[model samples]
Target: MARLRRFLDRIEPQFQKGGPYEKYFALYEMVDTFIYSPADVTRGSPHVRDAIDLKRVMSYVVVATFPVLLLMLWNTGFQANNAISQMGMTGLDGWRNWVMSTLGIAHDPNSVFANMFYGLLYFLPMYITTLVAGGIFEVIFAAVRNHEVNEGFLVSSMLYTLTLPPSTPLWMVALGIIFGVVLGKEVFGGTGKNFLNPALTGRAFLYFAYPAAMSGDAVWTAVDGYTGATPLALAASGGIDAVKEAGYSWSQTFLGVMPGSLGETSTLAILIGAAFLIYTRVANFRIILGVFLGMVATSLLFNLIGSDTNPMFSVPWYWHLTMGGLAFGMVFMATDPVSAAMTNKGRWIYGALIGFMAVMIRVVNPAFPEGIMLAILFGNIFAPLIDYFVVQANIKRRMKRS
Candidate 1:
C-alpha cells in the first residue's frame, strides 16, 4: 500500500496543472485512480455520505462478470478442441493443431486443463486487442476533448468482449469498440450521458457492418473448417428435434456447454453473475423478473400454437430460457443501468418488452437466430419514453390526490 501510495504521489505532481505532463493528466489519473481510490472526494451541493463511488460501481460489475469470463475461457477452448477431435482432423486445423499435438494435448475438449489452455489462447489475444485498440481510441478522445477519461470503458470494453464470437477477427474487435465508444457514447457526451450501452452499440455496428464475419454457423466455433449451429439456429430451422438431432440437449445448453459467444453460452454462469449483481443491488431485480416473466409467457404462447412447418414453435419455455443469449442479455445487457428504463414502473415495461421481443425475433426471424442483442438495443431506444409515461402517470395520480 505504501509503495503504491508513494509511486502515485511521485507521479501525480507531473500531471498537475502547469506541470510538464499536464496535458496527459487524464491518462495519469485513469491509471492512478484505478489502483487507488481518487484522493478527490465529493465536496459540492447534494453531496451525501456514501463510501461507494463510480470506480466501485464499475469494479463491482467487472467482478460480477468474472464467472462468465472464466466459463467463456473453458467454453472457447472446448468448442475449438471438440471441433478438432470430433472431425478427426489434426492437420485440418493447421498449425494450432500440429503445435497442440506436438505438446501432447491436442484435441481434448473435455480435458479441463486443455480446454482452459486453448480458451486462454483465443481469449487473451482478443482481450488484449480490445484493451489496446479501445484504450487508444479512449485516450485520444479524452486528450482531444480535454475531458477526463471515463472509467466506464473498463466495464464497456469487457461487456463488448464478452458478447463477441470467439472467432471474431482482431481488426473487427478494434473497429467495433472504436465505433461503440466514439459514435455510441462519446458523441453524446460520454458515459452517464449516453442513451445506448456503448458496448452493445459497438456490437450492433459489427453485426451490421460485417454481417458475414459476425454471424453464420462458421463463426461461433473456434476450430477452423468446423461449423456448429447455435441451438437457436437449429430450433429456428427444425425446432426442438433439430436441436436433439444436432446432439445437444437442453441440459447442456442450460449448463452453458454449448457453442455460442465467448461468455454468452451458459445460463448457469450468467445466472451466477446475476445473483451476485442482484444481491449487491448493482442490477435492478424488477428488470430481471420482468424479462423472465415475459420470456416464459411468450414462449408458452408459442408452444401452445404449435407449428408443423417450423419446429421452433414446439420448443418449451425452459428451452427459451437456456438457448441463445437470453440469460446473458437479461442478466447483463438488459440491466445496464445507463441505458435501461429509470422509473420503477418503466423498468418492468422495458425489461418485459426486451424479453418478449427477443423471443419473438428468435422464433420468427430465421436470418438472425440470436435476438437478445437487437431486443436490448430496441429497449434502449425506448427507455426514455417508458419512463416518461410512468412519470406522467405519477403526476396524474398526485393531481387527483390534491
Candidate 2:
C-alpha cells in the first residue's frame, strides 16, 4: 500500500500541496484537489507506494451516477407501461389478447412490471457488453504500452449510455461503445490524451451512422402505438401553434414529463447529481455556473431576436435548461477536465461558447431539434484552441508586467 501511494504521488499532481488558500472562496478548489491528491496516481517512479488505485476513481463515477440510474428505472417503466397499454396487452389474456387486440389496448397493472423487467434486461446486457468490449480494448492497449488501465472508461461508459435514448437497440449500443472505446479514446492514446469526450464521440458516431435509430423521434414510451415526442421537438414543431398556450408548460419541462434520452428527461435528478458532484468537489463549479448562465443568456437572446418566426422561437430561454439533454450534457459532459479548457479563464470561454453553440443549434438548425449533444462535442473540439489563446494572452500580460 505504501508503495502504491508513492507511485500515485509520482503521477498525480494533487498529492503535492501547492500552497495555502488566501480566501474562503478558494477552499472548494483546495479541497477538491486535496482529498483526491493522495489517490491521484503518480506518473513517475522513485516514490512511496500504496493501494490507492483506479478502481476507486471508477467507483466515484458509479456513485455519482446513482441518481440518474434510479430515475432511468422509473422513467423507463412509465414509458413502457404506457406503450403496453396502447397495445391492449394488459392481462393474462395477454398473448392471445395481444394477437387479437391490435390497436385499442388498455392499461395493465402488469405492464409496468413487464416494462421494468424488459428495460433492465435489455439495458444491463448493453451496459455489460460495453464495459467488456471497452475493457478488452483498453487492457490490450494498456498492456502493449505498459501502463495501468486508465479509469477514464468509468466516465465514458456511463456517459455513453446516458446519452442514448432508452429505446436504442442492444446491438447498436454495443457497436457504439466499441466505436467510442477504440476510436474515440484508444486511438488517441487513451483518456487524458483524447481531444473529445469519448462518450460523446461514440454518440456522434451513432448519430451520423444511424440517424433514424438515434433521433429524438426514436426516443419513445414504447407502448405499441403510443408515440413519444421529445419536448424540444414538440415545441419546435408547434411553433406558436394554439396548443402552446393550452398545453406543454415550461414547468412540465422542468419537471421532466417530456420525452428525451432515458436519463436526461429529469432535470431534477440531474441537479441532484450535480449537487453531489459539487459537494464532493469532483467537479469545477465555476465552469458549471458559467456555462449555465451563458446558455440561459444566449437562449434568451435568441428568443428575443426570434429565430425564423417558428413556434420554437417562442420557447422561453429558461426552457432550454430543462429541454433535450442540455441539463445532463452541461452538468456532466462539458465539465470533463481533460477535454475541457484547462485554465480558469479558458474554462469560462469554453463553457460560454458551448452554451452559445447549443442554443444556436437548437434554434437555428431545422435539421435537429436537440442541440446539447452537438454543442458539447463542438466545445470539446474547440477547448484546445480556447486554451491556446488564453495562454498566449496571459504570456503577453506577464511580459507587459515584467
Candidate 3:
C-alpha cells in the first residue's frame, strides 16, 4: 500500500495541469481517484458537502445490486438448461456451450454447476459488451467536456446487463448501451442532470425498435424452439389458475423459478438487494412504501370493477409484486436519486403514481405484460413537476403563516 501511494505520488505530477500528460489527465484521474480519494480540497466558500459523494452512492447501489446479479447468473443458466432438456439436448448448444464442451463440461440441466457455468458464459459477454461500450462513450464525453469520468456508468452498465433477455445478441447489446449512455444521460448533460434512468431508456429503445427480439416467450428462454409464457403473460390470458397450471406457485415465483428477464424473475432476491439498500440508506423507504401502497389500492379497485373479459383484472397486489419486473424496478430503478422526486412529499407521490400506473397498465392493457419499465420512465418525467408543486405548496403555506 505504501509503495502504491509512493508510486502514484511520483508519477502523479506528469498528469497534472501544464504537465506532459495533462491531455489524458481525466483518464488518469479516473483510475487514481478510484484507488484513493482525491486529495483536492474545497477551493471556495459555500461548499456545502455531505459524507456521501457520487462514488460512495454508486458503490452502495452496486453492492445492493449483487444479490440479483448472482441470481440472474443461476437463473439464466437454469432457464437455458431447462429448455434444452425439454427438447432432449444432453449436450452444449450455443457458442458458449460449444466452447465449454471442449473443457469436458456438458450442458446438463440437472447439474447446478453446469447451469451456473452456462449462465456465466452468457452473462459475462453481455456485461463486458455493456462496460466497453458505455466506458468508451463516457470517456469520450468526459474528454471533450473536460470533466472527470463519473463512476455512475458502473451502476448503469450493471443495471442494464441484468435487465436484458439472455438470448439478446451481442450487436444489440452494444447498440442498446450506446443509445442508453449517449441519449439517455449525456444528451441531458450527463449523469446527475439526466431526467431518465439510462439503463431503462436504452432498453425501452430496443423494445420499441426490435419488438421481434425483445418480446414474446421465444426470447425469454434461451434454447431455440422452447416456448414458455411468463407468469404475467399467463395471468393475462387465463388468470391465476393458468399460472398454477404452468406449474409456478407463488412460492416458486418468489424464489425465482420462473422464466423472464435475467434478474427480474426472483422477488426474494430483489428484496434481499432492497433490504441492503434500505439498511445502508442508499434507498429511501418512504418511496418504496408508497409504491406498495399504490399497488395494493389500485389492484383492489380493479378487483371490484371485475372484468368479465380480461383475466388480469383479478390479479391481486401480491401477485403483482412477485410477477414481472415490479420488484426489481421498485427496488433499484424507482429509487434513482437523480430521476426520482427529491422532496419527501414528492417522493411519496412519485412512487405511488409509478406503482399505480404500473398495475393499471398491466391489468388494463394486455399489449404490455410488464409495466415497470414504462412506469418508472413516466415517474421520472413527472418527478420534477411533482417536486416543484410540493416545494411551491410549502413556500405558499409558510408565507401565509408569516
Candidate 3: Cα lDDT at 235: 95
From the highest TM-score down, the ranking of the candidates is: 3, 1, 2
| Model 2 whole-model lDDT (C-alpha atoms) | 0.71
lDDT of 1 by residue, 293-392 (tens): 8988888998899777767677888998898888988998898877899888999999999989988888877788788899999999999999999999
What RMSD, rounded to one decimal, does every model reach?
5.9, 9.6, 5.6
Off by more than 4 A, model 1: 1-52, 91-104
Error of 2 at 162 (Å): 1.2
Model 2 lDDT, residue 180, Cα: 83
Give the runs in model 2 whose Cα sits over 4 Å from its true position. 1-57, 90-118, 223-225, 240-247
TM-scores for every candidate against the unseen true structure: 0.86, 0.80, 0.88
Q: Per-residue lDDT for 1-402 in model 2, tens only? A: 577556644544433355232244355434444444533454642111123344444456567788887767656666666556556554533342353345443334355554445456445666787788777888998899887865678778887887887767778888888898888777877766777788888899999999988885645654444566777777777753432553667776676665667778878888888888777656678778878978888867867877556666677767778878888988888887667887889888888888888888877787897888888888889888988999999999999999
User: How many pairs collide in each candidate, listed in order?
Assistant: 3, 25, 0
TM-score of 2: 0.80
Model 1's C-alpha root-mean-square deviation from the true structure amounts to 5.9
